[model samples]
Target chain A: MKKIINDPFNFVDESMEGILAAHSNLLKAAEGNVRAIVRADAPAAHKVAVATGGGSGHLPVFLGYVGRGMADGCAVGNVFSSPTSSQMKQVTKAVDSGRGVLYIYGRYQGDMMNFDMAAEDCAEDGIEVQTVLVTDDVASAPREEWQKRRGVAGLFFAYKIAGAKAETGSDLSSVRTAAEKAVSNMRSMGVALGSCTLPTVGRPTFSVSDDEMEIGMGIHGEAGVQRCKLENADQIAATLVDYVAEDLPFCKGDEVAVLVNSLGGTPLEELYILYREINRLLTERGIQIYRPYVGRYACSMEMPGASLTLMKLDDELKELLDAPAETPFFVQN
Target chain B: MKKIINDPFNFVDESMEGILAAHSNLLKAAEGNVRAIVRADAPAAHKVAVATGGGSGHLPVFLGYVGRGMADGCAVGNVFSSPTSSQMKQVTKAVDSGRGVLYIYGRYQGDMMNFDMAAEDCAEDGIEVQTVLVTDDVASAPREEWQKRRGVAGLFFAYKIAGAKAETGSDLSSVRTAAEKAVSNMRSMGVALGSCTLPTVGRPTFSVSDDEMEIGMGIHGEAGVQRCKLENADQIAATLVDYVAEDLPFCKGDEVAVLVNSLGGTPLEELYILYREINRLLTERGIQIYRPYVGRYACSMEMPGASLTLMKLDDELKELLDAPAETPFFVQN
Candidate 1:
């Protein structure tokens, strides 16, 4: 209810308008569809195009990643709602080069359905399109049902690997393979200290007692595995890491990239504190951290929580992760 | 308080440990001084060193800027408290190359006094040191008493300009001049919807009615110029921009760099909506925005608010702003 917004009904459209205006130099609306955002210079000849899309609310996710070295375009949607198939098709067409286009996004029912429809449409037009669904939240499912897990911060790893492969002029199949590999090697889990409010609803999506925390909650306030008394940073880190590490079976001598992501409302100071405990636990297990990123890479709007993602890295994955990238919300050199 | 921290009294030390552990590749704690953080590859021969320090809780400030082509070092302090003179001297010594060091921080009494003492200490040790106090919060003082205003998010402009100048092998005096010029050209103001809580205090710093907002609130909950009914994003943006523009006397056709920074709890979606209106207002005034950066660049631990900073640019400042720099939290390439 305390949000600084104009009209709740027009939140998505108005937010996209603002984004396009502010990042005019780096992004533009698709020629015929304002819901689809593409890099200003898209369709680089003979290079595989990378595209992703999902609901609004998570900035730097679907749209913020559309840039020179990242996704070539993204289809945007209403808050907590997937973009329509038509919007996806428009973005796919806008960014597709002679090589093809790769579609990557979190594994949600609405998202999968819309993206599949768009892929079929693109195929009819002789534009090759492939899809990769990120399912890396270990707490969302058991190993036997890993494919049923929801994606979270681990999608960032998929984006980086796929974007790097496509930027190197790889074929569509190669980009898809890289993305799938990254997702398969990753695991994430989160604890929510508080809930986030939707602009339209003007109320929290869910609620918990002041002294309680929800473990394994989804980015959009999906019911988690358990709700328990609030614990300190070290305990929370241990619970998250224990679940994720066991799921991946990350063992001694394993090398990985660590992402300690805040869920919108958590401060960087607390994230770093959480990261400290995560680092200590990983070190005690003899796992090597190749590169650690601590910040709000992915988030739910105004949710007080944090997530930990570990992506087991091979030499190729490490190289791709270290490749130069520039975007409005993320930058690496 | 609903914070994920252990031992609130030791929050600063534990957070620093995590930061050092996470960014060990780019940074390291100064030898014999755990509170002093220096770039891993510090003391670049014959290059002016840029150092900054302030109270804790504001991540990405004070310490996050200490990396290649940004800041050479920083002195860490307790929550909302300035670093001691000994801490400042240790960091200055750790990063001082033959070219000397330039100290930059917010214009706060404790910070200024401690840094001045450190400067004298460095002088006796035969190390050249110059200081520039940032004062860009237009809401804190009248135009005739601008020097008394508190520094806020606008300090980031001073850091980027001075760091770029220092990286160019400029001497101490030249770097100091660039920093001073940047601070003079910048203006900022913020509105707070809620207050922030310190870990040790376990309570909000201040309070506001549910339907009220404090305009021009300081980063640390200092009283603002006005309190009124909370307005929509468009109206809020207009008030902030109008005040900042008039304070700078920014004329039509002027070029500037815009920073729409979050005070921790404001989501990017809301910030973008705010930015949308900011862009519209500036465009209507015929002001040319050179480049706009939007995110939580400087924050006050989970405070629900946003600040707008505009730095009028000259040819030199523009070039410096465009220069390449890399840090854990910020990167331009």
Candidate 2:
């Protein structure tokens, strides 16, 4: 594997320096240790500021989403590693405007421990902070225990709702409610055809035969649920879409938004092929399409395979999603 | 180099069948043709129908971007190959609701021929279709005669502008004007760190050394301007950004939208590292950024490299961009 960096460890710092410098007009990091990227225009108001924090590899999702229509701020750690609690707290302090702040992020032990500690520290700073760890990856757990799964790409849908609520000057509770609604209504399943090579590790994170794939792999180098020889696009689609459709359990007339996300290495051609099959199954089942997204939403370096996310859209979400949003990563009508 | 297909020629057909079946609820292609994925509720006279067509494999760009705030229909051809004139005409005829349509797409010889022919066919069919090709790859030619260079990912910007205008009920001419403005103002340059294997050919469209990248390569596997040893992200950014900046003559205080697009195999982590450096160089020159997009907008089936697109934006362009639009690929404020 080849990569560009002064050193594996220096990669993040160098990136941080360059991103701040280039987007100085719009982006900046909060003072102190967290290295959270926040909008330069983040204002001081008595409004609840919503913040998210996670590892660094998933660009645009954890950080690039920080802008007018998304996250107010984000705390990032090393590749596939969780940020420190202090870092998370520092960003919360920087973006907090007195109405309190909400911490919404994926559910991971490192993230949960760090964010919970950060929330406690925020209270010590005289700022009320609440957190909701999104656990939308249905493949990670049984249906009745859905919340035990890791939060994957579906957090993006939550961000949209939370960001819009915050943008509307909603309070912390309201923002959190909207975000939680989005998260609760969302379900995701992922497959890995290839593994990622950590920049410093300089080897594959996991290995798969050229003719096999693993479903339910996390952003990290975790093993997936299923390991089977690669099948044609149709079968691949069936395997993935079945999981998604089953997890979401959408009825024939149920409306749901679809997100077909690539985990970095999968080709967009394949993504569309996958989506074509997914939609076919949904249609044959009489599902109503709300919104469909086909792209790389959250990725694990060059890891192949994809994740399918189905978000049960509500009126609030439909309006907010349809609302204009402009971020470094996503732009929507 | 593993692929899922029985026969080389059947790859495209099988993939399309799977796609149409999957997205049956929201997307459908013209019978017997893989190009032109249209909304099931076609013949939309209530809104201006937007049509775009180009080579395949640059996923989500031409087809996935064809929903909600994006194109009403898209004519996708073979990998790196343009759709036939009949395909374009069929798509136009399917999407045209007598509301007039705008044909916005990339500038490629094959696409130019087919889109033109399709427009003529649409004209004979009593449907109005205006065409505009986005030619922005600076490396394709020198700045003084930039028009000759073929189109690349810069077409995404044109699609947004035209899509937004059409969504706003703007006439075909006005939408075409917006798209043309975007094409004229935008400039892009791409480099491939490695080559991508075509599905049918089952081999790299071309080859590059493991230690080198092909700078300014066509998205369709065309040769690049240079094949130099790969350098750090900063140097790579300088090489691509310097050319794009110089070509566009982005001056101090000029507001430009920066897009760091992956060809296919590059990771978001890598793109961020690349963006960090690219932005740093631009900031030093005092260029203001409206927004920066870092993701896989147009890809070539896992080819590794990134493209830098600089679009000098004015108020008019900015507003059109912020208009509400939704597609399977990107949503913008």
Candidate 3:
């Protein structure tokens, strides 16, 4: 209940309003539809357009990535709820530049169904559409059935690489391939010390004892793999890294882009503390860190937790990720 | 006590270690002195150097500002404690390129005393040192005694302007004037819904009842001007903006830059929600928003609150603010 919002029901729309208002030069509402946002110069001619969408609350996920060298458009959903197929179709049609559209989003039941419907709807208009469902949360499924897993912070990697590929005037198939490559090589896991309340709910989504932490918790407070007593930063880093690295069996020589993402309430200082340990443990294991990103890339609504994501990178992905990107929430040079 | 840290006393040092490890290309310890960090390419031949330092918990405050177009060096401090005069002097000498050094930091007693001492020591070495104490927190003092007010997030503005001036090869006096101008035009105030626990203390710095909130609370949980029941976002924005704008008496048709900074724990979504309202109010008041920044530009560990800052802009300030700057924590293009 302790949140700075006007009407709980207007949370998503109002947040979108704030974003568009702040970054009008970089982003805009697609054809006056607040639910469908696209880059200001969205339908770039002959360039493969990358579109993404998901439930709200995770800023910089779907909408925050809508900009040059990132996703071309985003269908914004309600807080922790999927957007409608109509909204998704609007974004798809708005950003399609005759080069086709590529959909990159988290692997959630509601999202999968909605995005699929949007793709089918776009097909009738002759706008070729491809989907890459990011399933990189290792704890959500066994390694053999990784596609059934949930996507968490690993969505960032898929977007970065896929968006870069699309920006290079690549064909839709190539962009989709780059996205799929990122999803296949990524693994993420999180530990929640607290839960965030949905604005409409007016209560915490879940709870953890004052002396405990839950590992593998979903962004929506879904059941985590285990509940354990609170541990120090290094111990927490080791546990999360072990779960992530072992899932990919990220070998000794593998290079990775590490993202230590704050779920919502954790401070940047703690993320760095966690990152230092992750850097040490990975170096000890002979794995090189290609680039380390530490901040709130993905989040629950003021939830107290941090997730660690590792995306094994090849030369292609390295170039793609290093490409400049500018968005309302993310900027790189 | 819910934090990710090991050996609370080692919190500052470890966090600094993490920063160095992550950004070795842009920052490095001065002469193996971890407490004194300078830009990787410090003493940029004949350019004026900017040296800033304060307590450690506020990431991206002093240390985070050291970079190519920001502060050239910083002396690290323990959580909520000032760095020693000796450490400050080391940084001053490390970054000085025979052009001189400008000292910019908050108007805190400990910081003032330490920085003054450092300047005195550096003066013995014939290194000209100028100081500008940021006193932008309008809630901290009456306008008649603005010099006694505490500096909060306004430090970012001073750094941006002063750093840009120095990058232009301006002499020390001109660089100091730019910082002073920014400090004079800026006003900031904050509201706290919850408190952050210092690692060594292992408890909330201050407590607010679950149903109550404090307005104008300091970054270190210092007393504010008011405490009342929780209010909605628009009302909160109205109060904060009124204080900031009226204090400067920001006139009609005046263009200004707005910074909506999270203390730490507040989510970016909430910050944007607040920004949307502030933008509406400013527009209604005939005030123009030049460049709006909504994020954790300054933070207090994991405190749940936010501060609003308004800096009236002129052509000169606008040009300097728009100039490019890159650091470990901030990047402007």
Candidate 4:
């Protein structure tokens, strides 16, 4: 992969600097630590601020969600790695009001350890912290072991719903509950047509023959449940939707929001093409789509493939999803 | 180029069908002709309607701009090809109210021919028509012959500024002038890291060595003015910015809107990396960046590259840009 970057050592920091500079009015570094960033108007009085963090390389993830009606602060780590507990602590303190804070991030061992340490540290400072780890990738675990599933694009829903709930002046527990509900109601699965290279490593993360695709592949190139000859867009969509829909066992009357996300290098045109098939299959199955989002919500560098995420929506979830949000990467009004 | 598409021949129409299905509330096909699309509430009484069209590959370009505070309708063609004159006529007629209509599109021989034919046909129907051709690619022609240059991402500014002007109930002439001003003030240049394949062709549009990058390439893989070994983000940004800035002779203290657009396959992370350096260079030159837009704006299929656009802004342009606009692919509030 040909990446347009500077020194590999400076990749993450430079990218963060670029974001801070471009959106100075909307975001700011926490006490000059670029790794710990918060919304410009952080610690909004009487509001339960939401905090999130994860590795870099995923634009619009980790840091891009820090803004109005989304995460208030984010602890950014190196590419595909966890942020330091100190950085998480800085973000927690920077965004926390008297109402407390919530940490909602993808489920990863490194993130779990770091965020847990940060939470424990913050508790000693008289600040309450709650966490709702996102584990919506169905391919990561069987139904009986869903808790072991890793998070993927479903993190977008957790942020939007929980952020909107927090913006309503809800208590930390209420916001955490909303996040948990979103996390439980969503399912995601992805396929990889090609691999991405880490800037410093200077290599393909994994190898896949040009004529084949790995279905249900993890964003980090983890082994997938299936690898087969490449299929057309319609066949791909049908296979993905079936896996996700069946996992959720979404009934005929269920109304849901659909997200056809580009992992990285896939163009918007292809996403829409896939969406057409997905929409048709859903309609055929008598499932109504309340709203559809087709674009790059989360990515894995320049990996050439896509992911499909479906979130079952009830009245409250629908209202929260409809609420206004303005993150650096996502905006819904 | 492994594209996720079925029936390469059905690519354009299927994609259009997908867009309509995903955004039914925001858009609709004109008179059941999917090739001619219009805003769901097009033909606003007493409002001068703006229409645009181009090939299919560039999302948010020809069709995505059709919505509130933007173009009223669009005529979509095959990949990197022009919409037929009849398709343009369908769009023109569908969007025209008692008020006149204006055609704002890129400057291409085929597009010009088709749009001219459509204009003549619309004129016979008693609807006044005006046009503003976008010619912002500085690499295509010298300053003295700028009118001969091809259009690229500058089409974005034209739709935004002119579309907002029309939304204010401005006459066709007034809207045309706004678009013309935008076309004249902006300059853009691009660098391609790799080629894209037309679904039907099943081959790369052009070739670039793995270690090379082509500078000043057109959206359709037209021959670039220069090709060199791939450089780091900073050097690439400097090269593109210098070419765009010197062409406009954009002076110190000039307030401008900066667009660092992904041609297609470049990842968002790399775009920000490029934006950081571009922003710094502009600041060092005493040029004020009024607003910055990064990410995929106008694209060239799944081509791996990016383009930088700088539009010198005046008070009128600034106010127009700030006007609220909502489209399937773009939104400003």
Best by DockQ: 1
List model 3 lDDT by residue over B23-84, tens digit each. Answer: 89899998888889999998878899999999988876878889978899999889988999
What tens-digit string does per-residue lDDT give for candidate 2 at B1-333?
554344567666666665665456667776656666776667666667888887777776777677666788888788778888888888888888788888887778888888898898889889987778778988787788877788888878887778777777777788888888888888999888888787877877777776887788888877778888888888888998888888878889998888888887887667777888787788899987777777778888788888999999999888887776656566553
Question: Model 3: how large is the Cα RMSD against the reference?
Answer: 1.0
Identify the superior model by TM-score, candidate 1 or candidate 2: 1
Residue B307 lDDT, candidate 1, scale 0-100 = 93
Candidate 1: regions farther than 4 A off: none
Question: Could you tell me how far off, in angstroms, the CA of residue B14 lies in candidate 1 after the best superposition?
Answer: 1.0
* Candidate 3 Cα outliers beyond 4 Å, as residue runs: none
Model 4 lDDT vs. the true structure?
0.91
Worst 10 residues of 4 chain A by lDDT: A324-333
DockQ of each: 0.79, 0.39, 0.77, 0.74
Q: Could you tell me which 10 consecutive residues in candidate 2 chain A have the lowest summed lDDT?
A: A18-27
How close to the true structure is residue A301 of candidate 1, measured as C-alpha lDDT?
Answer: 81
Rank order by DockQ, top first? Answer: 1, 3, 4, 2
True contacts kept of each: 0.68, 0.51, 0.63, 0.64
Per-residue lDDT tens digits for candidate 4, residues B1-333, read 488999999999889989999999999998899999999987777899999999999886879889999899999999999999999999999999978898998889999999999999989999788988999998898899898899999998989998899888888888889899999999999999999889999999778998999999999888889999999999999999899999987889999999999987888888888999999999999999999888888998778889999999999999999898899988877
Minimal lDDT window, size 10, model 3 chain B = B56-65
What class would a CAPRI assessor give candidate 1's docking? medium
lDDT score at residue B307, model 4, on the 0-100 scale? 94
In candidate 4, residue A116 scores what lDDT? 99
